[model samples]
Target: MFNKMSIINKGILTHSFKNINRNFNKNPEIAYTIREKIPSPLYITTPIFYVNAEPHLGHLYSMLLCDIRNRWELLSGKQSYFTTGTDEHGFKVQIASIEKGYDNPKKFVDELSLTFKNLADAANVKYDRFIRTTDSDHYDTVKFFWNLLLKKKYIYKGEHSGWYSISDETFYPENAIEEKINIQTQRKMMLSKETGKEVTFEKEINYYFKLSEFYKDILKILEKKHDFIIPRSRQDELISELKKMGKLDDLSISRPSSRLQWGIPVPNDPSQTIYVWFDALLSYLTGAAYPSKKFKSKWPAIHLIGKDIIRFHCIYWIGFLKAANITLPQQVIIHGHWLSNGIKMSKSIGNVVDPIDIIKYYGIDPVRFFLSETSVLEHDGDFTEERLFDSREKLISKYSNLLMRSCGSNFDIQRALERYGKMNLSRIKMEEFPLFDKSVIEEIKQLQDELNQLAKNIGKSMENFNLHSVTNNFIRILSRSNNLFQLCEPWKLGELREHQDLVIYLSTETVRILSITMQHVIPELSNAVLDRLKVVRTRRTIEFARVGADEAYGASANRGGDHPITRITKRTSSYPDITIKHQKAS
Candidate 1:
């Protein structure tokens, strides 16, 4: 029911607003670009990952969500810029490199950053820019941003004191820090209630951003935009917290370079280094060609990030943008972390999952499919081999088997498609149906109605960025198609002659829709499916994902039991079981 514009464009922030600071550029330019460049390529981003550790399942899940949204935009005849890379500069990475016996932090980050890049390649996460904090342009941008903030009086030298967690690389308020006993040492220690990481009271003179100035501004934006953050509940959580506190503390934006020597130094002060988060967040802008004369990217990309990083993004990043007069991002999406077999992933637990190994064992599409099928925003999703195996099997049995049965060995699908695929059976009266049983005709009508519903539902889902609902819509239609296929017994319908065409027409129509709609989630497999169905490339976009979108395509759809989705073979690679996390202790 959606037009192409409706499917591809989530219009600018629906509310208009005056800037809290009269000097700030604010949303007016953001709105101008959104309106003027309506046909421009969409922009999407994933949080530049921290490089203290190797890539894990949680990292892949974040990429999967970004890739899905980007692919959806692309398939709908829109261009999309996708950016993802490493957050290489941080106290965590500095200490981690020292622990790993690396003398040069650059070498350490270089090696780890490639591992993330390689993981993206292996997982088929097609990123446009792999921006790194260490990149030359990023260095310029960070310095430029720093000077701009200083010029605006948003930066001031101050003594910052708080409960600091080296592991988390952030400060926590007094109320957020609590004493807890270290289980292994059986010793009492202060831990951050927010992250459960041990925190030590640290006080130092550093550069602080006047973050408190923008507390009300951010609260106003959240209230006005209403949908600025994805998965509404999280946005509501932030709004509630913002309203309850009604104030924010000035944020420390730098550290003494003697203590943290591996980061970007402040604009004029070499003795001080910019905060890791302050430097890292600029990767998005740098990747988008920010502050350039030839600014090709429209402002306000949709940023996909993990829930753990929401506070930093909503509070610090927003404050910095407001101060620097940069356009605020259109939206931010927070996804829940992936648990290893229902246990939280932790290095101490030895439960961290290396996603590339799984991708190598099962191939990219299955892993992509599994992640897309699991809804992460509601809560943490548990990734077990059994769960993966189950999801893989259900897809194979329900969709692949259906494809094999309807288009391959069990029926004369080609003949049926040739005869009836172009006809709109819904427009014909009930009396015109060629059927042996009245239920068969009714079933055909039901399948046709469901196919129409599939189109409407997917458009709505994609428009609203409800990713899980898209897959659910596909599964529902696939199930109904399977049921209709079973009732008609198209394999047996051939000799009966009249009933065969109707059965094949209805079932293959459903398969065609499934193939088209599912292309965004499982691209490689969907390509293979479309190839097997003989569907031409041009018709593979979203517009053609209808019941009878192609009649000329199924001339060669007879692959017997062979379907791309039916790849349930024993994996040739021996993937380490990540689910053993809780059972095996470090």
Candidate 2:
């Protein structure tokens, strides 16, 4: 009983916000030109990988997300900039260099950095810039930011005392302390693996950034931009807890010069070195050509990061930027950690899944698709080989089968169009056919409206970084489309020669709808739809709308009621079976 017009209006309302145009400039010069015309530029950055260890699936997950968003922005014609790279500062790297028998920090870090570069390359991330904390330009930028903060009185020399985890490169509060028995040492210790060490009752003088001052400001920002932190629940819980705490202490921003001297020197203070977090987080700006005229044009758009490090990205990073009077990023998309067998994957466990291993087992596309589909943008999600296999079978197989079958066995683009065009001729004169269902047009419109609403809801979830809901909605839509196809029995109609046009019309329209629905998640599949329809690339030109009323045989009035002879073909055996083989050699 839903009016088709009302449904259309509702659908439009739901998805209208998602229609923001992206200005993609493949050439940096062209991107600069486009930046001048755009109201705002979108800058994105991935967390810099520490060079102490090799890249893992968790690292790839973060980078791939940035890549996906970058690609989407490009496809939408947005002037987008993306960055990813290595954090080469810290005692760990210093110790690692010595342990590797490399006298020079640069040489040791460079070797480790290559592993990250190769991993990113294998993942097909088209980052505009790859930053290395050791880069002279990056060093200057970090120092400049630090000096600016210091001049603004936001930084001070202070004595810091806390549990520092070298592994996590983080300090833990009293609450985070865990009493564990060190079997090897035969002693009880309050330790945090996240910090990579036990709490020693000691204090040291170090540079500190005054983050507590912005507690209220951060809260206000969160309130104003509810969508800034995704998976509303995580944002709500995290922000609420912070507000209750009322204040945060200043953060330590330096490492002892004697212990590790391979980092950027503190401005006007050669004896002190910038902390790991300070240098690493600054890569976001440095990678985007910050302080340069080009960087001023495009500042911060969205920051994609793992949930484990949300505190640093969302809190400290924002505080630092605010202290410097710089613009905060539009959004911080926090994704949950990927657990293997219900436990965090670690080198000690020998359970860390290398992204390359998965890529070698599958192809890049399948691995990318599986990760994106399984990752819940705001909550912890499990990553298993079995889950990846199932995703491949369900999403890839079914989707690919739909494409091959819909376009016919020949796979010739021109032939498929011709066949579709012929069917459209019959549907042009629907009034003349006695058996033609006129009410079906209304049903199709209603369904389109429902699809629009679903798309809008999904878009909002995506905007808020609630990828779990996005995947859930995607699966629901796919199920509905499959059910609708089964009930319509377009294959049966192919048997009635006279109704051939009607079958083509319904099938093409259904395919169009399915194709448009996939634009956000599986754009590769959507591209296939555009190719099949032979439509020229145009902005906001949906696949479903490309096939006009004339092409829809159901709308025709000239077609006779007489049924034509069914031309049966062996090729029309349900859907094609798409085989997905592992890329790894047996």
Candidate 3:
């Protein structure tokens, strides 16, 4: 009964070549599980946006990438929770609201925060909770963390003298400060845009977090857990610089109530309010349903942020967590600033891009693909309309073209099955199909190997957020698959009677590979490909099959095989109509 099993299995068996190579040195005695056991209530968060400004391309890129990761984990059978929202309490927000003639900070912040929520909705970001720093729950949580730290002697009162940028919501040392003179007013300015004016305030006494105490521990953590930060070079540089400095001064954790009344008040003292960093970073906990017993299970995962704030995330955030006796996030993924046409993207430069506008014009998938593709996780890259247009074209050619050819061919096969009855005349044996031939069988094996290697590389890159290499590799594989389709001419073969079975075999295999690759970037397209292939949607794990029995025979023979063929007949056209237009006749 099973003698022909091996004989009829060659085509389906070839798909396992990559899997076999991946586990080549593993012992057969113990089965290694590829999936990790996900703890319940998984917590993931993006840096909360400040409501002082509207959303931009840089903000969208970080949030959308985090959304993609969240969705992927959910699809992979993990209980995932994602949190994103705006920081409503800050000196900048206070100043901006006052400038708008709004006396009530809550009302003003509520209006500004909605813009960020709308942007998330536009991008299809499914955050479990949208945290507002001004929300009572988040305020309480921030107070709780602050009191805990103070009681532990990790916080103390001090006088902080520094140059602060209101626009940036950051304090700079004397060396880091830039000076500017107002030509019209004929006055020297410190360029603190948060106040929207150049004004220097003298030093003030405030509560400060003891950041220097955890300096050694932070360096040790970085050294021991190198994977804790993405882009190893960035991590090394951060750790090295911090070590050279030896210790940093305690961070001021409060703003005078008179200066910024919009912030959360310090727990023990009503005279001051918590600083923006103290309140904003606490969103990670509040958004996670923190202080609940369930949140402890999913305490840490990853933190995604821009390179400008790497020191805050990699150093200050870690120090705070360590002092609070909380588990640090698994990794800090840093990405470079998004520049426009070789200049920093800024409204003053007239080069600022709105993320919502891009999505509306180019579609969500293309925008997501472009950001991931053009961005190098470790270093900065320029964002240009030309680059986005080029990436969009490549996506259409590589994945979209393969999708149409594979499924369209499968549609043809289903029609044949309907006319000819279940294909029973198996003309070729599994062993007779050489794994190295230029035929469909060999191509399937090669694609499977390439895809698996790509996945592994992506995994390694993700350990330090090296997105440029990962996205580039995806493009390369997509190009190779497209070239394969053209050379084999599977569409031409589908029309011939003698080559009918071969066409069905090739089409089904192609659809399988396309479906798997699409799962990573464009999931909706992947689903459309699966539906076209006539595969029943089930909980059965779909592993990429490199080699398999040719579809010369239907699902009748050994339907119980590891790789079973299930017929799918329902079809709806879901692919994009991508037409390239030339601006001028060449």
**Among these predicted structures, which one has the highest lDDT?**
1
Error of 1 at 433 (Å): 4.1
Q: Write the per-residue lDDT of candidate 2 for residues 1-586, one digit (tens) a residue.
A: 1122246554553343222122212222222222232344467788888888788888898887787766655544446778888999888898888888998989988888999989888877778888999898998788777877887789999878987776666667776678898778989887864443676544677898999899888888877888787666767877876877777877888877876597888888877888889889998878766655445455666887776777888788889888876778878887778776565666664557778877666656567777877777655667666666677665554554444444553223332345554443323454543445665544444444555465456445555545556566656655555554555555565444344444444444455555554454555556555455443455223323334322332221112221111112222212111122112321
Give the Cα error of residue 103 in candidate 3, in Å: 2.5
Worst 10 residues of 2 by lDDT: 557-566
Give lDDT: candidate 3, residue 462.
Answer: 48
Ranking of predictions according to TM-score: 1, 3, 2
Candidate 3 ranges with C-alpha deviation above 4 Å: 1-42, 178-201, 408-411, 414-444, 451-473, 491-504, 539-586
Each prediction's number of clashing residue pairs: 0, 22, 17
C-alpha lDDT of residue 500 in model 3: 45
Off by over 4 Å in 2: 1-38, 173-178, 182-186, 192-197, 409-461, 466-498, 509-586
Q: For residues 1-586, write the lDDT of model 1, one tens digit per residue.
A: 1133453343421121121122125522232232333454667889999999888888888887888888887877777788899999978888999999999989999999999899888988887788998999999878877887787789999888999999988888787789988889999999988788999999998999999999989999888998788888999999998887768988888999989999999987999999998998888788776655223334567888998989988888999888876778889888898877677777775667679877776678888887877865868887776667777786788887777776755566677777777787766555664554676676677778777677567767765556678777777778878887787676776566557777777777777778888777888877787777788888887777777777777765775536676555654323345545536755
How many backbone collisions does model 1 have? 0
What does candidate 1 score in Cα RMSD to the true structure? Answer: 5.0
